[model samples]
Target: MVTGKAIVLSVLVTLSVVVRTASQLPIPPRYDGFVYKNRISADSVLVEAFFDPLCPDSRDSWWPLKEALRYYKHNITFIVHPFALPYHNNAFIASRSLHVANKINTSYTFPLLERFFRYQQNFYNKPTLQTSPATITQQIIHFALEKTGNSSFEKFVLGFQDKSSDMTTRISFKYGCSRAVTGTPYFFVNGIPLNIEETLDFAKWKSIIDPLLAEQAQAYT
Candidate 1:
């Protein structure tokens, strides 16, 4: 009994409703990392960093990043993603060690990363000794025990190495590749790529981040 016009109107209304529902749904968060400042806020800006612990450039980048973390501690959440480049001989093993350190205790993540960066040359320059996967794994296990003073952490690292370490490393590497990351020390602020030059300059970083933080503050006011 319905007229053609009424049928068309009903279809249009249904389609509009579907579109509105889809638009209102929240987008899923991308980029998982070792999260610092784990609070959820509408105004909070996320800073995601992709780095290899052994890369000199990544090590250099950490100083400025530390300064930024101090300056923006209240307004931002920082996430560290390990992207192990193939060229770095021990990168994969080093990244897996970081994952192991994070699993045993999140507190150890930065320290372990710092240790690896600090001793990277020593790890690289093995003249008489051959650095196989098992050798590196043992070295990390020993390093973790020495640093953490927790003997139980050894079992966790060994288990991770045997089962999930490679998978976890690959997943992080693939995620970085998907995002078009081709080098170490890449950063994303609020899902946008942050310039390397800006990363080192506090004034430049503040210029980009302050405006976003201001917008968030205005919304509350």
Candidate 2:
């Protein structure tokens, strides 16, 4: 026979355990954006990276990120979200091009991104005058034409130059904003924000990510 106070205390303790367990559970991957599904395990941790092609910080982080992805390719699923920063003159066009290219051919996504980052500085005009959006779009179209030699892709790019493309770009930007992303090269692991500093260090990233994978493995076992 327990007193009412003891019964209430027991209920609270049980609820706390339930809450903690739920908080530790892995979050399902988002529907939007590219998802590199893991071949090893469906329970692999999810990594969401928000990047701006024109951002120097994002460019700096790209190599380390690729290394980590290559090393942990079996243990994690990666997704990329383009967040165009307002300060860059051609950031919007760069991001929109990537999005549209992905739609046209998923294979084109990474090569185009690499090209943008490789020649990022060339895309910007003098500090006194910004490049026009139309010019930037044409540059991207030219890149696609040269890479694929697909006249259909050129037609698609020209046709996509409207409010719809603007809306799509805004939607992608807002998705990052809603997640409290204030800058490029931001990352989330298992639905939690990962420190940018840690992201730069491959060893630190492995330490942080390995445990998550192990935990997921234990859950399956």
Candidate 3:
């Protein structure tokens, strides 16, 4: 009986140590900031998202919101920010790559975003996988080639890295840190927090978005 008790204690100690170590690791950056897209109006009810490409919840939240965009194009402006947490091995590189893509071809953003989510494990850090920035860039470039059928992906990728990559990363990280935003798929519609896990309802979206757009429209009129 005493020997069994000792074994149990040892197991508990091991778990405790593991838990502590995991806890000490940096949490992935919280989704934060305002990213406006295809501005149709001066005050198009702005929607901002803090997202992680590898996060399942981010993937879940993305489609519905993206679908809603088509219907609300003239009435709303949507912006994205990358609040990638440091603990996530490839998140920073992924986020930086996103900004690069944005500058090269704005059209590439959503398609690439969807691809990463659909193939999350493709980018997840593995013990044996090369996780350097160059490798990550190649992965993105390959995806772009397949998706866009653009042979110029090489030029676009390099241009993004050279011009706006670092700036975009800095802005995303700073915005997230300042807002204390910490989650995979957090959003604000007209500066109001969106409960993505709960409603995410298209009709529910209209309820909030319509009013903001109307208010802005009235102000302009």
Per-residue alpha-carbon lDDT of model 2 for 1-221, expressed as tens digits?
Answer: 89999999999999999988874523324445555532435667778888998888888787877788889876778888889998877788888887777667677777778788887887765631665667667777787555555754755565466565566677778788878999989999889998655337677678878888788778879
Worst ten-residue run, lDDT, model 3?
A: 25-34
- The collision pairs in model 2 are none
The lDDT for every candidate, in the order shown, is 0.76, 0.75, 0.70
- Candidate 3, TM-score vs. the true structure? 0.70
CA deviation > 4 Å runs, candidate 2: 1-30, 36-41, 125-130, 150-153
Between the candidate structures 1 and 3, which one is better when assessed by TM-score? 1
Q: Model 1: residues >4 Å from true position, as ranges?
A: 1-31, 37-40, 125-129, 197-199
TM-score of 1: 0.77
Off by more than 4 A, model 3: 1-37, 126-133, 160-164, 195-199, 213-221
What would the C-alpha RMSD of candidate 1 be, to one decimal place? 8.4
Lowest lDDT 10-mer window, candidate 1?
23-32
lDDT of 1 by residue, 1-221 (tens): 99999999999999999988874522224445677645445567988889998888888888777787788886788888899998877788888877777767777778888887787775664541476777776776777576777775656567565656566777778778878899988989989987555336666668778899888888889
